[model samples]
Target chain A: MHMDFSFSYYIGLAGIMVFAISGAIAALEHKEHHHDVFSVFFTGFITAIGGGTLRDITLGNYPVSWVKDENILWAIFLGFLLVIFFPKLLTKLRNELFLFDTLGIGIYTVLGTRIALDHGVNFFASALLGMISAIFGGVIRDTLMNEVPFIFRKEIYATACLAGAILYLILNSFSTNGNMNLVVSASVVVLIRIVAVRYNLGLPKIKIF
Target chain B: MHMDFSFSYYIGLAGIMVFAISGAIAALEHKEHHHDVFSVFFTGFITAIGGGTLRDITLGNYPVSWVKDENILWAIFLGFLLVIFFPKLLTKLRNELFLFDTLGIGIYTVLGTRIALDHGVNFFASALLGMISAIFGGVIRDTLMNEVPFIFRKEIYATACLAGAILYLILNSFSTNGNMNLVVSASVVVLIRIVAVRYNLGLPKIKIF
Candidate 1:
């Protein structure tokens, strides 16, 4: 059995916490007067794990990480409770949301790519898996919240993930150390996303009709 | 490896067709002032396979149902094209939609329950898996359309799937013939759902604070 307190696992737990915070913020935005704790927690938990669950499934990895790892589940609940008690801790909601989402995609993309490679997927498919892992949680969260997925919006969100994932794969092929590859690839995603949001930049719209 | 052609596979393909039609109908409902073919096809295809895909993932079934089965992909496309070319074929949209959805859940619940059992899940989890396979496709469809999932509404929808799933398991425990169990269990789901929708029946509401 793998050690429970691995540094890698802790980093993944931190990513889950970040995603749960964003999910809770969304739930808070869409709260009905009749909403309860279950609704909030379920949304947050699902958002925290949706992407990785999908990635593992796609790669035929068994036991999906959260099922065997109770700490991961705890991290999501902790994140939700943090939001519930200190909503003001996430003041500047829009900016903080963007930051959290960027961190989430950055971390997940690199991690997902590595896992997919370990599962023996081709480089291209692994990169695609990375992008899927990074963005699908938000896609699911928006769907549950009755909104068109944020990924479908006019933003550089998914593109940033795709770029970073591909970059990670390319860097791996260059014999760079794994730590350097992860840091550089994830930072590229974060920097691109930050700049895009700052300048309201996006891909050019096409009139395909 | 499973055969290229099987009675069971054909039945699943038919269910895919039913789900895709409903998804296409929803896409048609929500068409923008300017939208394209890709959007419609994607929405329809996703709806057709969404439930089964999730079911297999949860069971840790490999390659998923649609991924390795080219014919399954073809079935979804056929369903989408049918709707695209002849929207009028599904006139009286409400009744037809109910019929299609009811038929879909009936077929999928039994099949999914059996698949989950084969994957060694306990009885309760198998029943839950059956309901998941029956409902999640529509759940995904509604989400993608930026609506609250239909199953979350006041309805007998998920309950019908659950009852049928439990019935199938009970019958299987009695050493009932496989075909007999499949037919009877699926018919119960269809009959109950049809009656519920006809009479506007739903589970009683509880106001949880």
Candidate 2:
């Protein structure tokens, strides 16, 4: 039990650092496109929390996350500077960044679902919100980068979040313990993501033909 | 007084219609890109309310506009179908659509600013939220279309919103009558948009050369 707690703790901290660094690197990489530093920071920060903000707005949740927390602001600023000054330091951790990403997807999916359900959004909309909460940031980021959003390309990313949300809703209806639902549902998302990556899985494309 | 009320009333109704029809027309215009009807509907609807929804979320305003109003949802559906069945009807109205757009920008900008102020967001952010409320829908739509958001261009659209928001703030601090502030502030946005378009004015581009 203790080991599990510490494992998640490290994942949380390390994941944030990796996420921030990668975002910074992404900003730096696009210098030729003429993004001023402020623009870079804007894209990176939105990529980090845009999904949550979108969810909160749709659900009418107040103050949003970063608005109520100064740490998030400072962390973004620090992440931006960290990448600029120590670009060499990121090479070793590039592979492990998905740990942070997976954790984020899991937490955000369940959290957004819960919030939507609380606000009396229909179960269908709640599930969609969960998926939106997990992926919309990437949607916005990709859009800003002038590319088709990757999730629309038959990737398993949104599908995983959607599945996790459905599972959470099902477990909740059965009157499962709240914490049990949280752990199991989130863990399922994490498992699916890791397994998909390990085995090279993707959703089959549609056939309009 | 009656004349003023009726003008705004017509602007309100016509603006929503024009906004929806133009959005639908935009969807039809992109048929070769292979957007399914559902995708077209999603993009068109989001462009119509995405900005206001963004504002409500940032300010913690509850139950956003569309959720509380079934008319908004019905209007989007009707708009979608209108263009598909009646393509020839929109040509004469194309040039006049800007009237609806300008009214929308003016109303959304000042309305967003007032809400943010009520939520105790800092003045700087309030000004920004006002601009976001005015233009972020287009930003999202453009992002989804994989193009640079037109607002990010040196076009004067966002500039007008930003200016109107600041003007509202200045008036609001003097404890101006709320209705008076609403009228004068929104009019300023409308005036700026009209003048900029009339003269083909644009912000000067930076020269790193």
Candidate 3:
């Protein structure tokens, strides 16, 4: 039980870092001269926390994740501090946002699947919940930014999370050890996202005419 | 039964029109000399449909408000057309936006309260949901424009919805007739909003240190 809780904690932290970075990058892109460091930091925090918060609220889990653990708050704070102190330097670095975002996505998907499975949800529902936990924050952030949701536009985002969630379920049937499952499931999400980005694989857009 | 459905329908239409006009006026206020028509139109549509759509989704109603009724769609379309065709004229008539938006706040709150009541939710939960339904869309629009959510800032927005919803429950206990009850509830919301805005009444902000 201790192992499971800590594993989820670490994975969730990593996910927050990634989502925050992505949000920061997006805010930077949106405003050329408006160096609103506070806005960027707030956006990052929202992006990281938004999806899981939605999942928990919908599932009737109160007190929320960041509220429960001070570590996640520190992570967001440090991330914001890092960006603020080194805005141009961090923004200039190539692929850092992508790297962290991919890692966060994978880790979050595994954590979500684990939580749903622990709650005794069915496989399909678990997978869907996992994907929701992973992608909904980005969707919320993008929508609030007046842009089409990132999941609806680019990258293999939702699909990547769903695939990883399904893979976690498959891995769990073969073994019940908690740590191995976390590693394996997170690896599945990470690998899929990496390959998808490399090969430029994504879902075909639904063309409304 | 027919009167109940028709009353809900008209209430929803009024909400949509008001929300759209509010968005258009907001866009006009955003820039003094330059008007971005597309942004205005997009914001208008989002404002019009946003609150009710969120309400339906969170309440687990599928296909959402606009999708469920074609008349709602037509209302949105007509609202959009009016704003798109007459941006300057619409901007000049800004008082109409407040009247319409307050009316929308009332109608949507009642509609949301009704849906929750129909679903057998508790009074407090129903009232809270009603407020969320009425205010969330405008919160969203403000956030997308990179501003603080309006409800969280200067307005007694959510409070108006909650007050109206409370009145709804109180009236329901006194009367069993649904149509009359709904009309009374909606009127209560509109009046509350108008009075609050006119008197500059709002919730006290909490200072966290």
Give per-candidate clash totals.
0, 0, 0
Q: Candidate 2, overall lDDT? A: 0.70
Chain B global fold similarity (TM-score) for predicted model 2 against the true chain B: 0.86
Q: In DockQ, how does model 3 score against the reference complex?
A: 0.05
TM-score of chain B of each: 0.91, 0.86, 0.86
DockQ of each: 0.15, 0.17, 0.05
Tens-digit lDDT track of model 3 for B48-77: 778877666555656676776687767767
lDDT of 2 by residue, B106-201 (tens): 877877788788778766567768878878877777765656666644347777888899999989999759778978988999998899888987
Ranking under DockQ, best-scoring first?
A: 2, 1, 3
Each prediction's TM-score versus the true structure: 0.60, 0.58, 0.57
Off by over 4 Å in 2: A1-32, A67-72, A121-124, A205-208, B1-53, B56-114, B122-128, B134-146, B150-209
- Sort by lDDT, best first: what order? 1, 3, 2
Task: List the lowest-lDDT window of 10 residues for candidate 3 chain B.
Answer: B200-209
The candidate that wins on DockQ is 2
**Candidate 3 runs further than 4 Å off:** A1-111, A114-171, A175-209, B1-8, B28-38, B84-92
Candidate number with the higher lDDT (2 or 3): 3
lDDT of 1 by residue, A6-29 (tens): 554566687798899888878878
How does residue A75 of candidate 3 score in lDDT? Answer: 81
